[model samples]
Target: MTPDAGSALAGLTGADSVAHWTQRYGHALMDTFGAPQRVLVRGEGPYVWDADGTRYLDLLGGIAVNSLGHAHPTLTAAISAQLGTLGHISNFFASPTQIALAERLLDLAGAPEGSRVFLTNSGTEANEAAFKMARRNTGLDESGNGVRRTRVLALEGGFHGRSMGALALTSKAAYREPFEPLPGGVEFLPFGDADALRAAFADGGGATVAAVVLEPIQGEAGVRPLPPGYLALARELTAAHGALLVLDEVQTGMGRTGTWLAHQHPHLGGGIVPDVVTLAKGLGGGFPVGAVVAYGERAATLLGRGQHGTTFGGNPVASAAALATIGVIDRDGLLAHVTDLGAWWRQQVAALGHPLVAEVRGEGLLIAVELTAPVAADVAARALAAGFVVNPCTPTTLRMAPPYVLTREQAATFTDFLAALPHDLGEATP
Candidate 1:
């Protein structure tokens, strides 16, 4: 083999062989989502190894949760140290790390100068908390026919979570149809078109319009981003209608999109301040943590006593992990690193001249490569064969959410490999 062509072959992680683990170990596990792709045993930096000891470059970053990258020394140390100190206290009390992380998230979000935060275990719960807060703040009880709030407005193709309230906001029909009776009364507006949003809320007397929920940039729809004025328009319309704007930054928050919040992008920010912001994914930096931050009186008086609670939500270990990850990101300048690298990386991939590639989009460490043809699955298999990990958001769309820890050299190498994807897939070879 030529020196640059590749590495060794003994026990190498060829794609077909790695699938064998799904046969051996996966049988014992329940069939939640069919079978496992690979029995990932260890991870470090931007790579993961299967049970056969084959390592592949990881570009997904655990679906954008591993911000500092896998098994990062600082993140690991902080979690371990915190676990040794004070692991869990339930939601009945406050842990210093939890309080500090909440304060840090609110401070970074720049929520009208002063904001209150509600802690939860995951993004769904965080969103659930935000929903409860909005309902509480409305001060219109569901029973009284008092003010009769009719609906919440969510954009089409936007994804928040799988919970009943959040699912009601998600636009995908497949995820919602089966689970009907889902706390209805929400209007679905086509994304990216400000006119649609305006038209939807125009009829409602604004009394029934409780809140407007949307991602600053949509991530699940293969990282589809809104045009410059859409988010700003949503903010304006929501405010005009007396409806609160809820920004779902679960996947876009933290430094994933080069800024602490993706909505901070000038085109999107547009001097808009939201009432509720829900975050998860990158918040804990691979540890399980989620939060709902409420601004003004809307967040303060909502959900009074015994309204909602989570047991393992905001454990000290996860809080420490978030604190360590945030510090390292700021100190190491990873935010700027993601911005510069993200821009350059997308440009290089766009220049690949592959027939299969239709477009590439996203911000910072979150990105997606859209293929003209519906060959994303085959391309992913091919890329895995060549020793890189990627995901197919749709049959024609592939998403890459690499760690902010990815080096420039690594991004460049992936670009080169992506350029060859069309040829490999056409050959019907893996």
Candidate 2:
């Protein structure tokens, strides 16, 4: 090897470690996510080690993707065994695991007998599929003639995804402005404002809208949940005008919020089902898999045979990984465990009397700490320095979506970690 290259390699294998890797990353990788917090090298249940061998509690859980935790034996075995048997196939063929995974998702969603599913590789693709389905289905009537219902409504502070179509549905301006001339026929409304939704329908001539998409709980927007009874009003409004109610449960489904779906939570007043639900994130437990589940006749039949397809959507390996994730969540009774642990963590964190902590809000493993000061980023940095990883969703909000396997001891340790932070957490970096 060349002299400089040899020295860099020696540094990577020696004390410099992630610093050298970080410098190389800045030169070679895109700046989409800015600098990564650390160069993670290894992980176990609720813990990850950086290149320096410093272990962290991993409370962010890969932004809610590691549902079963790092290097989970069940999940790894499922994926590996499936890969060995039949790795991948195009949409022209189907695998038993793929079909079973879809059936399982429908069962967990509590969908009716006629419900159907369309699988994708990520949450963005899942939202895109749902978006296309809404347009294709709502543009035609029972007899398949042309219709004027083409408009779509989404909530402010809602984050659907980052693809062109899903980006249009996402509410953040910064994420949208860079890619202007986005798909039209979409309207943004104040979240949880039932009056605004009703007025929009009335002003748009009632039947001009195709769908209303929403996140049961806004994950990227600091785990902000829908206000009480708001979803019920959304369901009623959409049903009355024949507009589809699409619930983007990408980050809240698959037992993340102590239930199969966050809408099924007792406080949300169960039984208010939506027409479409998009899921991903924790569904595959770190393996890439997404699904768009449609309930009832209208939404289920939206996309016919040839309307939408993906090459690697339901590959056997991904399906196996998802099935294993669901099985573990059920077999281990993680739903109830998450529910009780969330409550306990919230109570303990709030009782810390930390000046920076304003409040803790959210359900199950999806929790957020609203800061009294705009020091969320500083707090996150300090937390990381102390060997715990947390995410700052906004300048004033710190969010955590830890794995379901997280124990009470680990949860309690995080509380103590925060309690030990100094009153002033450096100046808030942008």
Question: How many backbone collisions does model 1 have?
Answer: 1
lDDT of 2 at 158: 89
Q: List the residue pairs that clash in candidate 1.
A: 150-208
What is the C-alpha lDDT profile of model 2 across 1-430, one tens digit per residue? 3237555433234665778668768988999989878887778999998777688999999999999999999999999999999999888999999999999998888898789998899999999998997787465656877657888999999898889999999989999999988999889999889889889878545688889998889989898988888889889888888888899999998888899889999765376888999999999999999999999776888888888889999999999999999999999999999999998999999999998788999999999999887888888988999888999999889999999999999999889988887776633434
The prediction achieving the highest TM-score against the true structure is 2
> Which stretch of 10 consecutive residues in model 1 shows the poorest summed lDDT?
1-10
Report, for all candidates in order, the number of backbone clashes. Answer: 1, 0
Top of the candidates by lDDT: 2
- Could you tell me the lDDT of residue 164 within candidate 1? 95
Write the residue-wise lDDT of candidate 1 on 1-430 in tens digits. Answer: 2323233233446553556557654756687567777777678899988767877889988888989889989888898889889998887788889889888877887876557887777888887777765566462655754565557888888888899988888889999999998876777878788777777766656666778888887888888888888888777777776677888989988888899888887645754678888888888788888888887665655667788878887878878888898999999999999999999999989988887778988888789999877788887887887878888888888899988989889988778888766564644533
